[model samples]
Target: MADKCHMCLLGLIILCPLLTGMNGAETTHVFCSSGENVHLPCNIALSGCTSTTWNYNRHSSAVEMVSGGKKKNDIERHERLSLGSDCSLNIKNTKEDYGSYSCIQYVNGQQQGTDAHVHLHVLHGQCFCKSHV
Candidate 1:
């Protein structure tokens, strides 16, 4: 009996860190051309998400992109904005859309939350001023 208890304690000690690591927020960088479409991954596997929002540094605050199974008015909203069933955000890439974004996940009747951080970089054309000799 003592040996079984000892083994259980050892198992907890080894798995504690791994379990905690699963809850950590993941950060990723995405680069897209100024006139293309780019998809930002969010809740790829989480279910029962009561609400979800996407916050961008370019905006004043978090915008309710998806709520109550619908999309709300957001400052970042564009004609090509698309929300996937998995909660991924698809945006028509533009220079104005280049910024750090956070996908917030909310569960019903829960206070704690999880999120994914993404940094968007828009590739734009370069112009050079040339002077003829």
Candidate 2:
């Protein structure tokens, strides 16, 4: 009985930090559009990220990104800018592609954060330059 109790306690001790995720980096939604271009931003909670992945499932492949700087890799090879702690994704213009987006991060060694999901809503309109009357 004592051996079993000790084993259980040991298991908990080994798994506590991994589950708690000590000061891990985080990915949050900045702003995203439907018909227009969408931008996704991410902020690092901690500076212990050896590496990470910026995931947009709708896109063909996942982006292997390194922490400590800005990221600007769009879905369709856009030449815009993604900026720091801000991983933006532009969907161009589409109604069928209006859905959710995620930027899953594999921090430290274990899969810690994967819950940042952005929803898309398509719109139709035209904006022309206008001067004050």
Candidate 3:
């Protein structure tokens, strides 16, 4: 009985740090209006964007927007996409850009850290008209 209790206590101590580190990787929410420009932030900050990659997922499939610090021109919305100096993914005139954006970092062709997730919510503006008699 004594040996079992000792092993359980040791296991908790070793797993505590690993569980705490998982909290650092969290999802961020960004809200924007239609026809407006928006930037999705990356949680991890590195020296340069040479190892950064951005992907967008609207419903099922994910499309790569920026890879290796360069924008992919073959994408549908390539003209409206740009990468910021700090590895952020920027979109111009966001109309159908409401989706999930992920920022991943790599080094030496291998992924370095966990992916940073950003959820974009697009809100359309409404107009209210009043009539006076």
Instruction: Highest lDDT: give the candidate number.
Output: 3
Better TM-score candidate (1, 3): 3
Candidate achieving higher TM-score, 2 or 3: 3
Expressed as tens digits, the lDDT of each residue in 20-93 for candidate 1 is 33436555656554676778777443664346666666555545556543456654464667677787777864
Better of 1 and 2 by lDDT: 1
Per-model root-mean-square deviation over C-alphas:
17.4, 18.0, 16.3
Q: Which ten residues in a row have the lowest lDDT in candidate 1?
A: 124-133
Residue pairs in clash, model 1: none
Candidate 3 differs from the real structure by a C-alpha RMSD in angstroms, to one decimal, of 16.3
Candidate 2, 36: how far from true, in Å? 4.3
TM of each candidate vs. truth: 0.60, 0.39, 0.74
Per-residue lDDT over 1-133 for candidate 3, one digit per residue giving the tens place of the 0 to 100 score: 5456445444544554454334465666666557888878886857999999999998889998889999999988899988888899888988888877889999998898789877676656531111110
Model 2 TM-score (2 dp):
0.39
lDDT of 3 at 54: 93
Clash pairs, candidate 3, are none
Q: How many backbone clashes does candidate 3 have?
A: 0
- Candidate 1 stretches with Cα past 4 Å from truth are 1-25, 48-50, 59-62, 74-76, 109-113, 126-133
lDDT of each: 0.58, 0.39, 0.74
